[model samples]
Target chain A: MNNMKTIFLCLAILIFLVGGVSNAGTYLDSAHGNSTYGVDRTSTTQYATGHCAHCHEQHASIGGDEPSPDSPAGPDDYLLFSDNHTSQTVNFCFGCHRGTVGGYQTGGLVNRSYSYRAGGWTSDTLDNILQAFTYGPPASTTSSSHKLDDIKTFITGKWGYTANSNPCIACHNPHAVQGDPANSASSAKSSGTRGYPVSLPSDHADKYVWDVYGDDAGEKMSNYVYQAPYRSGSTSIYEPDGSTTTTDGTNLTDYVTLCTDCHHYSPTPVSTRLGNTNLRDIDWAASVHGGKASWSKTDADERKLPYKAEEKNYVLACTDCHEPHGSPNYCYLIRKEVNGATTAVAADTNTDWDTLCTRCHTYTHESNSCINCHYHGALHESNPNQPLF
Target chain B: MKKSLIYIVSIIFFIVLCSQVNAEVAGNCANCHTMHNSQSGSDMATYGGTSGNNPCLTRGDCIGCHAYDTSGTDNVVNIDGSLVPQVWHNGTKDLAAGNFKYIASNDNDRKGHNVAAIDPEDTAAMFGTNGAPGAENALGITAANFSCAGKYGCHGDRAVTDEIISVKGAHHADDGTIDGMSTGTSYRFLKGVLGLENTNTPWQNISPTDHNEYKGINGPDTTSSTTTPANATISGLCGECHGYYHGTNTTETGGTTSPWIRHPTDFSLPSIGEYASYTTYSIVAPVARTDVSAVSDTVNPGGTTDDIVMCLSCHGAHATNFYKLMRWEYDSTTLATALEGCNVCHTSKN
Candidate 1:
């Protein structure tokens, strides 16, 4: 019996050691799973690193006490401490991920707005995730946000999502989502790693690779047959900040494929900014902005930098003119800055579309408002033969 | 005196209880077996009723028992305190071997191995039968004639043609520890294959330390055996049906070095260059271990034999949502369009 006991103990020790070295699930590598600075900061047991208690309350309690005030009464859905979502301002994630930390939680939570990281706009004021989502007035026509309530409602009805679940989860898996580690290190606008933060929501569970976009082939903009745009005003500088050498978009994310997963011709979501379902469809393939057609500005002088020759055929990244979360700009969630220009250069009134258009194209056309002739179906639907200037 | 006797009795009871709990299959005989086909004036078979009386006088056949209907939220179900892993479940989570539901779906022949009865044979013009795509032309095994056990299947004795007889007493006689000694003691009952079975969680919710410990070798010389070799490895077991896929055989795999004809398996990942970046083990693209007696989750690449690539590095054993049961979306043209699979290990190729 003594010999058997010793053998059993040895086997148990072996199993434990082997399992410990393996490091286990993908969540352990995520930002939330970081040992020094992650969800464990909120753990009642300080050294319980990467424990599920940060998000899930197994028995609707924590450390032999009731959960924090942010949480709902009793065991919440999925054993989450708080209700998945409550409202635009009272969402569960806002407890820690917002600009202002709640009294119950620890402070010093830092996050950079997407515009600053991707567009190199140093003047971006949206410091946290919540501010970016609620940039402008609720349902305002001029400047619009992603509309969290609308997203929550749509996902619940269509994808059978649980009621009040965080709509942000529609695009981001918190457990497996990667964070901008560079942001934690410094305040530099262009310091971000440009990791693929947003998982394809339709295939959210399938996400495996991240942070290797610059090195990988298909994930980078260079693989899209792209011709890099120039920085605003400077003829030699590139669009992704002031790179002297011309590029084939080696430093841009393939936002076209990621955004088009939902914003395609048929199954496009209802547009909150336009206040209509009919305004949703954006078939990039058939449009002048998308692939399949070349820019038909006859004179090279008429076009701006990067479009040196006539009939330039190049695919454009969606981030070239738009902000992902929201912006303080006047129309279409347009960027506060574009083509590495000074901040707020693209902000304009509804009629003043040239402010955004001239960031890439030369302001030579008669109409200051490009939308009058360059609507979604203008060139592709009305006059297929006519070339875009 | 009385208190000491009580303490000693309690200790012995705890030991006996632990031993009983470790038994692979411990439950009432009637839960699985049937003396006669009649029970409470009805057939004892769990599926298809009286008409589907299975061989070996068991309650159900392989699919009938293993693929028992779940709550659409569970991968495992308890029958008389005996835990059973489901291969066809609607739950969000699936076991390590994967689920068979993908292949059973309409027009999804490439999604998985299309077993007979459970799944229809491939009807594509290229494949009149459900023959494996990369399999050698001589060894004929197709979906039309494939089954859950015996000659054409993975589990139990491959030489035996009878499904029930091939895996005769495996379940009842299982001792839990898998030493590759017999059908009952083999890893997941894969006959002669050697591995450490994750008995507690089975194959569901696997972690690096808690996953099956697969057998592998560094710089393998498989020139001697044309068929699945005497030394059993997980890759070697797969080589039984798909010998062409096994990388060690010089004739089958062209050559062991780079600039190869066929993609190599059972080959050590070079520690230097891009391969070294994969210092951590990824469940998405798992490797095998040189020593099955111990396990390590970290990858040493060129430094150790534990970084040897196997057939499973690219494919799932049962099924997946991707084409040809690939672990990742191989058909995606752009990385932005879908998740990376081949590039997970190839590192620089993406």
Candidate 2:
């Protein structure tokens, strides 16, 4: 009877082990999975549907057929079927993301001509997004933009990303994209989904959403809660109702917080960062646009903003005046006009007081009438002893 | 006979009073004239080594009558043992208005005005260390020239050259008070000139209180919106030539800012802060009179009207031994001495 009990216990343990593997594979098969890459005959094959021949070969494959031109072999390192050079990481994403493939819409192209990437794009949209990546020829001396060939260099050197990675996979999960659907409201575009903590590498727990609702009972309480893609030093999961829970997993909808993940962690000082890196979290704190004093002076309903009733409070977000992706104007300003002026002002042009200041001031004064009340215009000229009229 | 004697006594007394009032050109007429225009057949009209039929029935021209004799004595007409003051002289004593001999002696160009026949035409560069700054003269005059009692000279006609036309009807007038009116009321025969003046003669040993009183205003316009005042002051009189440096007008000052774009003149010294500490009047940077009626010949002249900043605070009417006709050596003075010179007014800078 004791030998019979031992056989039954071993058989039950094997069944439990198989059940755990199936559950893990099901989680990875969610809609956020990378359907284009990393497919092979393995225990996790049941979760993926893409063919493995697209990226790998079991034995020696044809020479010079690698996806990237810089790859050392036909089947590059780790049988990536592409070049493993750091510069070719973006090119790999470009394959499926650029226009339709196999008569099916693969993904959006970066150029403005395509409809997939056309939600709210302008002529300079791609150039603005490319500003964060460092993979192009060296810019001329006159160019004011930042440039680096390796996206991983910025991740490791400035953003403290220790794991080897590419830009898209670094911020997005190829398997399970886990976050509340409501969190998509904060993206630069509504089409993009929120990021999930599981997408990050195992060693990158410190980069996950935590204390997002400030409900952490320990010393890990966060000063401010942020939306997904943006990370703080919190371990708590985000919730939909603006509250946090230890048992359930959800994400907040404050998309500007996601941008802070890379921006706020720069190794260089905010004052010295190239291309105005301090605009979002740092400069916004001290700027007049960020302060509530000017906004509080007027009724909230009387404000001239273009937000919904629920989002029309005096407290402004960075997106109120700036477009995250790109804009025709330099610095990605939302509107090309300033003050009350009719003309669209360039970044280098002088401020037009009528168009810009009267937006909130609401008074109809002449453009050159600053000296009527202030001591700024021409000098006094009449005789002092003359009778005043 | 008794009434005739009384009339003669009255006439003599009136002449003596006239002599005392017009002391600058007093005494008998013979001292400046020759009746026959000949003395021992050497024509008296040819005196002073000049050739001309002497006009005004006088022995010499304007220069000769105003200059000193070879004996180094001033050409003065004495009467009743009273030595009347001469307008021009080369004696050791210098008058309140400096003598023209300095310019006549071929000395430095700055010694005196380059009056015709006394000195050559001014050939010096404009805006020199000793000349007026180009910004200070709104008339755009690039060089300095001289004429007798006319446009370029010191009498009423500021736009004419004839000596008789400029000094017309000014010599005989005996009024000594400068009531900001007629030539008789003008101080030092500056006909039609507007300003306050010290009526007291023998203009020497002048103290801060005993000096010439200048007309000014109560205070500057706080808004900095006005320029010239309706009434003229001593600074306005100087502005007749140096127009740019006087008023707060942008046109005059060539600036776009005001109650002043340049240093302010005829404005009151504020009675607050460091200015209140000035209990005593400074001879170096003397204040002027905003209300001429309030003036008194006393030390430490006190009143709100007595605290005005005037052009005379930094300049002298006649020539001085310093550059730009400044009353003091501005370059040599240090800022630490706040109690003297510019620091007296610019107290905080010290």
Candidate 3:
């Protein structure tokens, strides 16, 4: 990233434009002019991270794309100064954290598009790079109704904004948003309790007593096994209530919603929807690996989920199976059949069944690795072949 | 004396007629020409006696004279400005199966011709189109190493007709030109025709400098020139069939905001680039082509983009039909789908 530092540097230059080249009205340092774009969801347009003046000048635009000439500049629609026209547009995000002079720890998220120049990047593979940004209901592609009304609406939803809020200012102070001082890893985030510093809420009301980042976790956290819950081989933790104790706060191991404040819990049951099918709710409750906390406590075979090893076992969020951002692999593939053929693209085979299966179960050293051993279905006899392309 | 002479003459006459019919492609006047003007029940013809397949010639002639080209040599020498390809049978011509060019054979692959499909019911025969509607329904779409994507099992109806073609010779019209005036006007025009941005309207000739060569090589000219008709037709042929691909500029609808678009920018299809999609929208940027970068001083000064693509770019349309219209990169039907296509333009250097 020769330009990794350029990301942070762009923001510093914006400080002078906010008001003056002084440290008074700017976001981090007042150089350009004063800006109030870092305010919360409830704050006024001038002082919140969710404000308009955050990323745009309303008059002196920044990026290549410009608004129509006849369009008035008063209350800029969507608060965006201009459209992000370049193919390397992720730089707009990197211009802050991955910029010069101040980021490393938080500058890790790679804009997969800018870096990986191919056809499409699988959402799962690319997620490895965008770890810091929290997402809304993913692409909602799974027969579920989690559809994002539109892109910005989709973006705002995931970044902790209502459907009708301003998105530009949510992460930038236009005056100070230049890829300079504002781009520092530390500067990217406004002082907040959230993992990301782009936008934080006032009163932080979304920080309710529910799961994610707040209260409902007190009961589940009691059984917290530091590293890998089941890895250390220590089985001492238990609740006052027995195994069947239900949400009465009994014997629940994986009940803890550490990051639930930003992400909501699923209302679905944990038994029926295991095959990574149409899981409506956000929580991974009914998934094949959902009840594992308790299941692993009993059956060893319950650990079939790849990326599920306790030495690997950790908080299995919606991200484990799917990426929140868009993916090149059709269906945002955790895995898929090559060319829609029988063979898998990356894993042992191309089938989502194979990839998802091998994610947990061991395979051939035979082909349909799962079918090789366990007699699952007709897949047993199908002479599995890879695609030519 | 009268009876005897009559008998002898009639027998000789019958003998001569039989000999002539046998010498030809074994068909009755209908072998080379279509009669009754019917696109109906007769796949080849109503009373057609035939071999399993045929090339550019009739099936009867194919099996009659040239069943298998044992000569192991290429005797085809196209005379300049000729309407047909010159097939030299002077022992110099190679006794080989012709690619799906002048000779439309039963060989399974061709760049523009992707119609054969896997018969879900059989899997033995490459399910063809000369069957019933139900059979057509069963023949799913499949990419027979025709495209570089290897993923487009792209089977759409021809010109808005739902009649799926599981067997085809040329999907694009002859020679990429649209009727005439347009170069890449085969389908929707390479850069969008009926849609909003139709830039390829005024198609350019191979060399804008001269109009003579352009007109002469307008059709499938086997003639050797500074730029052959085959070469000129390659891009048009590709763009014609691959209408939506060449130069595309996409705008995501009502999303937070769709990317901007003024002039159509190049967005490589998965077929051209090392296609990969991490997320729904996470596409890897398109890489530049190695071949174009080599001789590209004018079009792409520093060689940033891959200008040459499609069939003719790699395979000389005249010299090949083997390995599916491939000019180079031949192994067999199997290998052609793999590394062959990709390696053609990707020079070993970078």
Q: What is the C-alpha lDDT of each candidate?
A: 0.61, 0.40, 0.27
C-alpha DockQ of every model:
0.01, 0.00, 0.00
Compared with the true structure, what per-residue lDDT tens digits does model 3 show for residues B1-350?
Answer: 99999999999999986664331223243433344324465444221243333433333321122222323232332212211112213243221112323233343333323322211222223223312111212223233422211122222222222221221222223422333222233222221111111122211111212111111111111211111122223332333332211222122112112122221112222222222211111001112232321211122212223332233333332224444334333433222122233333321101
Model 1 regions lying over 4 Å from their true place? A1-25, A40-50, A103-105, A139-142, A156-165, A185-194, A205-216, A228-246, A298-301, A342-351, A364-368, A380-382, A385-389, B1-350
lDDT of 1 at A202: 53
TM-score of each: 0.47, 0.40, 0.25
Report the Cα lDDT for residue B298, model 3: 23
Which candidate leads the pack in DockQ? 1
lDDT of 1 by residue, A192-275 (tens): 333445555555433333222233467677766676655544556565534566367776656776677567625556655456
Ten contiguous residues minimizing lDDT sum, candidate 1 chain A: A205-214
Please name the candidate that would achieve the greatest TM-score relative to the true structure.
Answer: 1
- Show the lowest summed lDDT stretch of 10 residues, model 3 chain A: A113-122
lDDT of 3 by residue, A96-187 (tens): 32322222212232233211111121222332222212221243323111122232332344434554443333333233333211222222
Give the per-residue lDDT digits (tens) of candidate 2, residues A2-99: 99999999999989998854543322333322233222223223223233333333111211121232234322332343432344324343333333
What local lDDT score does residue B34 receive in model 3, on the 0 to 100 scale? 43
The per-residue C-alpha lDDT of model 1 at residue B148 equals 72
> Per-residue lDDT for B80-177 in model 2, tens only?
34354444455655444445555554454454445564565355443233233322333323243444455555555555555445555555565555
